[model samples]
Target: MENNLKNRREFLKEMSVFAGATTFLASIPWMKAFAGSDGSAMAPSDRVRIGVVGVGDRGRALLMNMQQIENVEIIAVCDNYEPNYKRAIELTAGKAKAFYDHREMLEMKDLDGVIVATPLHEHAHVVVDFLKAGIHVFCEKSMARTLEDSKWMVDVQKETGKILQIGHQRLFNPVYLNALDRVRAGEIGQITQVRAYWHRNSNWRRAVPSPELERKINWRLYTEYSAGLMTELASHQVQVANWFLDKIPTRVMGSGSICYWNDGREVYDHVALVYDYDNGVKCLYDSMIANKHYGLEEQIQGDKGTIEPEINRIYSENPPAAPGIRQLLHSIEKGIFETIPIGGASWVPETAVPYRGQIIAPYDNNDTFLQLVGYVQAIRNGKPWKNLLREGYHATVAALLGLQAMDTNQILEWPAEYVMEKDL
Candidate 1:
């Protein structure tokens, strides 16, 4: 444990230096908050008091990650669900106060920030209230179930001038940070295409203790509570595409159907979407619950190489020569220019390169942990990272638009109503 802590401190020190670089900060402006003005790690005395709402799966995960960071206190937890509330209290080891209603917890005056990991439909309402109350927020992704709600949340944050960080962990991930550096440095050349997908065989449901708790326990499988695969899963990958390309889709087209998991679920079991960006860049996305093969991946392809962030691999367009070719080159350099008969297969099929590729980034701690730390840092500094909300907003709008396109069987243009003239 001590060794891990030491490594984490060292890694954070290195990242602080990396984040302080002018070129890297210019490209990823949000990372500027990662470094202190004095170029030192956040002091342990800079403690942050935190509250968590909707203490379910994602909320618990965030709690666990937050606890790992020094000087962070889980002051309070709120949940309407009994099981989750109990679990959260236990997870905090009884250190945090528990409340059935978020409003009651909001009455507490010491919260530096609140994490909203509520269901899709609850995000806007819960987050807006907290922001209006002058508390910083770290809401889970997709912003909200509806575009209007999502936009309204962004507006509320702007009005309040409090930190509103959408839970896009990749934004704080070292692997993705390194990949972004390479992308900006033209290591992969100009990005030509982007593709991302998530696949799993499970029904995407929780085991309900009773029939009465079905709706509350497994809200993800229903349309009234969630957009299912698109908002919950695709939104994360879509955000990655937006961040990497630094462009949101101007238009999107797609299709979806409940081909599998036909057990009374209101949402699609599979979906395929195509998002069109400026300069003819396209992001093709799809997700399915019938198969787990091809799992989750976001492939950013450029003229020179391809980056798969999930697996931390970069495949170059040009690979090194074989041993025989190198030997031939060696011979030629020594003045052995004998002509050899070129005999090979008449039809050589072109395929993906055999090279497994190189690791794109160094091993690091959990991205969620890093992101939580950034949130606290932003709170301490009283400065919101530029365009961070914009990234979340664009991705949420794109995902909702993709669902609209899929349902209507037509291409959907980006809605002008939600487009921000400037970053908030």
Candidate 2:
């Protein structure tokens, strides 16, 4: 018990430093920051207690990930819907308190942090409350549904020094990190273009048991609540694009329509977008709910090679020779770039696989779990992850800008407000 009291004091001291004042929040020992360094076994007294708001599909997934982390305790779970609320409580094995309203959950006073996994449109409101309470927040992308709301979240995070980690799981994926390292090391040569796509065959709707639940259930199809494919899916690829390019787009143009799924959905079922960076790099992106052929991919192309982190492959435009005497012997055996003509009829075109690639790293990269662990660690240490908030905001604004272009039928200029955060 004495150890618990000392832990509480240390936690408050850390938090007071964050708030720029010594006034501590409720001194519940459960709110103590984990005393262990990275990967250390945290006793219950040393665990960072967290509250989760909006236990929907994504929220529940995040909750499950949190349960896998031994150093974190989910002291509270919040959801407006009864089914989600019950499922989340069951997942917690009834160890957590349940609240229909997130605000009530915030009143618990023992929470060191909160995860805001509400719909994109609902992010700003829920996240702002957590920030105001001096609670660290992990908000899922695309930061918020609107530009104003996204900016508000960023601004509040700046005002309060609490850790604000937006969920862009690709930022933590080892495949992506290795690819990025290679790119930075000029393994892919000069990056010239990037192409990404997300394809699905479903209408992206929920089966509403009652007509009244239509708007609530299929919020992604509604313009008021969601931006459909762009915000829901493209947000991931767009973020990866920006991170690789190391800059935000200077301008954006796009077109989207519900040409296939004309089921009274306000948002588009297909979208084609192009983002132009000031450095003359272009990112080509497209998505469709009418086709599942490609599934989803982000292809980064450069002069010497191409990287597809999705498949953990890097294809060299020119495969270098094997080192030492074997390479010299192989070169002596065959003429460079000369095709042996005996394999197929001259009139018939025979296709042999042209490009060869090697897997740089072969680990089952669990991106979502990495993202959660990052948030927990940052919160436990009382520090924010560097530039994480800006990554989410940049992508959200880019998507919004593209939507404007699609709506206006003209290229839209990127907003200067984003320039404050984006180094570009």
Candidate 3:
């Protein structure tokens, strides 16, 4: 019995020592995946190798964010424009290999994922190519320049077993996340309407040395390269409305004009849209480059209260306080000699009173970085990504519907074919 007991004690001690050593080694960044005794290099199962396409302004920002995430490496970058390609290399500290063509970059065996930030028109081709190559994709918002392109991207995404994360950063924003939680918790009961607007005062003009450069740098001003205020600015609010309502708009109508900044651009400088959902909820969105007055980015008006997701303000209307005390005080101060009706007889029923309710402050984080982190983590873990192709397509379609309604001077019903065809 004593001999058997001694052997059991020895076995337990050895196991404990082995477990401790394994954990200690795992805690070390350099030895994160190894059993230390063998002195072999650790291979990370969670690290995502990323390639960047269209290293323009937004693409460079995405690349910078990706650089800050752990377990992710930027292996390659591609851009058609030479200036953008050079800028991307500078931004990445020249750590990634540069390519003039995206197809070549997609062929890099080391890339586990890619971020597509090309011009609005090129989004579909780039995204579809990367998806079909079995690489996860993070495409910028307004998924494509046209509805057909948006649909095609969705179909390709379904066919490919790769993650497709759209760049609607608000979907991952902490403020929106908390606001969604509060709305779902019934803090603001039955959201019936939403008001959203973005206003900016600018010339809405671009400086281009040549016509070729004009097409490149001033893409937002031309209809051929962009969808004007609807896709560029209103898409964000439309997405917020859809997220909060948990449904796509059933119908859309709006009007837009180039009343200001008449620089011969093909798109509008101001737009207003109304989205009607099947649930009877409505979202009002507007974007104007001629003014800066604004109420809020997005305000959800519910039965009980209102929630401003962008400002992180939530509150219910406060009930008026009784005016009897104020009237009594006024009567006393009047000394009864004036015969002024200052008491309850003269009191007004509706008086403003300070009411305090739940107020949540907005969250502070590099949302761009957080979004990239989620994308990289999902890619490495083989998990589903948020803001998939369908969401992007729907948002784009909604924006385009507003644009069409504006141009035609008619209320546009959501087209049946809008939801049907694939590829733009």
Clashes of 1: 0
- Candidate 2, residue 101: lDDT: 90
* Local distance difference test scores for all models: 0.85, 0.79, 0.73
Assess candidate 1 and give its TM-score to the true structure. Answer: 0.90
TM-score of 3: 0.78
Say which prediction, candidate 2 or candidate 3, comes out ahead on lDDT: 2
**TM-score per candidate, chains pooled:** 0.90, 0.83, 0.78
Candidates arranged by lDDT, highest first: 1, 2, 3
Supply candidate 3's per-residue lDDT for 238. 88
Task: List model 2 lDDT by residue over 1-424, tens digit each.
Answer: 5565455445434432332221221121211222223343356665889888988889998998887665688999988888888998998999999998988866677899988888779999999988988899999888888888888988898899888888888876657866877788788999999999999999898888899889988888999999888888888898899988888899999999888988898999999999999989999999999899888988999999999988889989877643444455565678554333342344556558544588866655667876787788787678786667778888888887788789789998898886646322
Q: Which one wins by TM-score: 2 or 3?
A: 2
* Cα lDDT of model 1 by residue, 177-225, tens digit: 8888889889999999999999999988899999988888889988888
lDDT of 1 at 228: 86
Q: Which candidate is the best by TM-score?
A: 1
Order of the predicted models by TM-score, top scorer first: 1, 2, 3
